[model samples]
Target: MSLHDTSSEGRLQGRPQTGSQPAIALIDGNNFYASCEAVMDPSLLGRPLVVLSNNDGCIVSRSAEARRLGIAMGTPYFQVQRQLERLGVEVRSSNYALYADMSQRLMATLERWVEELEVYSIDEAFGLLSRREGEDLSSWGRQVRRAVRRELGLPVAVGLASTKVLAKLANRLAKTQPAHGHVFDLEAQADPTPWLEQVAIEDVWGIGRRLARWCRLRGVADARALRDMPSGELRQKCGVVGLRLQQELRGHRCLPLTLVPPPKQETCVSRSFSQPVRTADALRQALATYTVRAAEKLRRQHQRAGALSVFVRSNPFNGTSFYSNSATVTLAVPSNDTAVLLAAALPLAETLFRPCHPLQKAGVLLLQLQGEEQLQHHLLQPLPPEQQQRRAALMAVLDRLNRRYGSGTVRWAACGLQPAWAMRRERLSRAATTRLEAIPRVLAR
Candidate 1:
């Protein structure tokens, strides 16, 4: 039977006796960042490796070997620098381009097996699956894991269940429990209570720390206990959201597959500088670069921003000397042009700059975004129809060149040729997949 079949006849054939039960399968890459690094360089496999966050400041991802070595996530690199070297652990700064490319490939591979897929994050996705009465979903999941491993050289855990929450729990078990062999199907189990009992209330999906505390206080310590809680009491205390979660845990689906994601309400481009920047020229350069990025994103989405905001901030950890300010500019006519965005954003950088404060971060935010189809033109617009078309054509050409060559193949003069305040990524890896020159070479011998 075809996995994509969803019609009544298709369901009848698949279900045979008990009727079809659609399942949600959550597939997540194991140690995604670390795994992405290993994919590009096979020598790192089975070795202790860690991927650091922006500026190489914090340990954001760790391989199984690294985790076993007691390297915790979010640990400052400075504190663990000595320990990592002593243990012969490899480290790499976040390579977003490589990771993003791998993620896209992973999603495309998954699309082949599932009826509908929702990309939840860079390393995780939810696939809607139709289970036949006698078909083995666990076996099907194994095929998925093997395919991803074979194609992308990335390890993944597959969790199939009647609901998203259970699928999430199943995915966690698939990762932590060696006996599961990296694929767990909650619906396949004759008795799911035992599995649910093994999951702590705090570890359950959608249950935050506060809610976990509340559950613990109420003597609900595990998924089983929470699932069996009185519906009225759960609803009264936690509202509809809580009730929906309980329903999902009880094998009832509440959240439907989001085949098409909703349009973004705002687009923001922000980053912390490698070093504190004090000069006005540096500040303007940073804001202009960020504005260009934000505008590009808007154009890609076929949306225009009605307003732009520029914010500058000093290190919040700098005690009483901390400074932060932002200014918003409303455009007469909505636009996604980099020049238009920079024109409005650069002036705000000058206005918000404080010479005494050493700014640590700056960003550009595009607000009140509207689709091109819904664009409202202003009566006193600065540009006429022909001029607007020319500007758009120029922006399109600029974007194409950048995409074909690489980011910043063509950029605004205001962005500065070599900004000292750029992000610090000393241990950065090559963008092997995205960039032509970064591709790995193999000797004929």
Candidate 2:
């Protein structure tokens, strides 16, 4: 059935929508990484907090207090070290394990109420609603928000709209406008012209800076302006994509929610070092570790890559003798098996290494990815039936054990004993929640 053609719906609370269906709700966690930290340690609440990216190089997540202090995303740690110390703002390394577990709990709570859902990111999801007469969407949204907060201790905002893009806009508004509560209902508003005018064209979902500039040149400066654009002219200017976005902005469903996120085309694992590496073996170890990590993800996704590439380079800081090199190889057979990947990967890493050169970073890239069932076995290099079965079983066992016991419970020999170039996480918080051994203790009075 077609959605409501007229924009004459009433406000959300206490009145049932006289429309065809309920609007899509975009529910997202607020300051997710920082919130995760604050939830675990109550002491960090209301204090300026920042979560650094890999290697503690830059600020990846910041709390509201941190923002008020002028800390921007991607600001290098070195640039604000003095300010952070002087202001007594706490810092933490990105603890992906804790964040992942909390995210699982958060989504589990949302899943109880929302059956048709799409997880857009680690901290964001979209849910479809079923409206009944006399039901209040605002009340329903608050219940969802409160449930997540009560169970998982994670705060979320909801934006309900006729389409996904509008829902995204509504979610943003929900965060900025907290007085009428953290739910924005576009479907309930008779006219959202005032709020639509405030949202810059650049802020709309699926519209990039380049597209915003293109739209601005045509006098479509805001969401309302873009929605009011002439369809034929927009089609001529930005092709069918812009036309569809225009239709979506005008409360039409042009895109459907993807319940399952698609697999990535290319998987690359790259990280900067805590300290400069001066040995070939160290660079080899880094490459081997990354290869194993990438292979784990590939196997988890039931995928295989036909080719692998490795690269190593000198720290750009020491400008005198800077050098970088890379090598790629096509595998005889595509397999997500760690042994198979490292067999092709470590040799390439050795070739890229240079004696006496300072290594700043090294990585592995898996390319030409395809599903495991679609593999083209090599006739010349075909493995014995028994040997192939054993390898597959071994890989499966490693995955299961690691998942049960935690990551790195099983790995290949080439990944090395000591990772000299690992990230610097000196200020990492206690892993009392995720790690069994690190669980907190109580002292009797």
Candidate 3:
């Protein structure tokens, strides 16, 4: 791992070196997905923008302009297209590849700021600042944000606080208040309480809409009220999460930054159908399709599953013959090979298939996983060396072709006939960053 130490000179002052008074920093990309779009295309700046969810169904992300137009996140496209058209919103599908590439660059830029850090989400990262010496965390955060902006052409909001949750809140405040200049220092403020009191309880981390409503009913609608609540009572009501939030709001660090990525114990690929599916063949086809997707994810992660679990279920809300069944097939050898995994799933699919059941959803799970390198070789029986080599070559070729051309350049028949099983992406504009046809063209005509 290459490390870059670019601690800003102006930002480094009176930095403490103790774990007790640990300082934490939260850095969030401003308008992440939408910002990434603007970074790639300068023309997108200052425009009404929206990024669609799978199947282009709903707005997953929106630019500042789109937000001003009152476009809510997750608002279904079919419901908002007319209004969006009137507002002249530039709609695009969630371009994971483009966003991912930009995220990588941004994270790389941030690596210079801290010795220890954790990527909290695709667009947010946290770093430990408590152990550093002669570092003015407030200035340091601002410098880091500026560096990211300059290097990647992406703006960021940086927050420094005693705890993760407070840092998150500070980042929010930084983004909302231009006076902070995209950086917020909770510890630096002499009156952090006033700011905390003004924040709505529902807006606090972990407090959902329902939880906010419950708090509002009790007239406990602000962070100040939540902090004053008896610990025992809060625990009884909202449990440990509430206690953590209260402690965090008071500038107490509770959560530790995870230096390493957490292990994913299980992998799943499941989706509901817009319409009920009938016929054993169709159900099996859906299962197979899901299986292929699951295997692809496993391969991407460089992990192998020891089991293939397949399931088929009928609609629970249909009030009809509600049936749900699943079967797990333990692999003789853990593998990321889609063909091997799919073959194991075929038997499970056969067992789960019931005639005239009208399956509403189907999925596959890769469980009992292990690193491919750590997998033990068979003692009595093993795949031939030639076959192993062939599989490797085949998968490498498949990955290359898909990466170069686009996904599904080569696909299994089991993927099914252009079905709605695909993710909802109705509002997806042309693939502005991936497909050749979608590439922006300069027409001089």
Best by lDDT: 1
Candidate 3 ranges beyond 4 A from true positions: 1-21, 130-136, 209-219, 238-241, 272-285, 312-325, 347-361, 373-406, 409-445
Candidate 2 global CA lDDT score: 0.83
Q: Give the per-residue lDDT of model 1 (tens digit) for 1-445.
A: 3445666644422212333778789999999999999999999999999999988889999999999998899999999999999999999999988998899999888877777789999999998867777455898898889889998999999998989999999998898899999999988898999999999998999999998999899999999999999999899988999999999999999988787789999999999999999899999999988999998999999999999988888998977578889999999889998888888888887799989999998888899999988668787765677988899999999999998878998989999998999989999999999889998999996
In model 2, the Cα lDDT at residue 167 comes to: 90
Taking the tens digit of each residue's C-alpha lDDT, what string does model 2 give over 1-445? Answer: 1121223431222234354576688999999999999988989999999999989999999998998998999999999999999998999999988898888878766665553677888999987766664344777788888888888788899888879989999898888886747887766766788889989898898899888998899898999999998899888978999988988888889988897779879789988888988787787788889999999899878899999988777877776588888899999988888888988988886688777788888889999899977768899998676987898899889988887677777766777775767888887876656667666777999
TM-score of 1: 0.95
TM-scores of all predicted structures: 0.95, 0.91, 0.81
Better of 1 and 3 by lDDT: 1
For every candidate, C-alpha RMSD to the true structure in Å: 3.0, 5.1, 4.5
Q: Which residue pairs clash within candidate 1?
A: none
Give the distance in Å from residue 270's predicted Cα in candidate 3 to where it truly belongs. Answer: 3.0
Q: Write the per-residue lDDT of candidate 3 for residues 1-445, one digit (tens) a residue.
A: 3332434542332344344457888888877888888876788999999888765767888888988888998888889888988888898877787787678777777766665679888998997766344344677776787678888888888888878888877887888887888888877777788877767887788889988887788888887787777778778888888888888877777788887776679899987765667666667677888888888888878889998888778977777878999898888878888889878887676788777787877889899989867766677768887987799789878877887888788788766778745555554444455678667878896
Ranking by TM-score: 1, 2, 3
Model 1 is weakest, by summed lDDT over 10 consecutive residues, at: 10-19
For TM-score, candidate 2 versus 3, the one ahead is 2
Please give the RMSD of candidate 2 to the true structure.
Answer: 5.1
lDDT score for residue 340 of model 3: 90
Candidate 1's C-alpha runs over 4 A off are 1-19
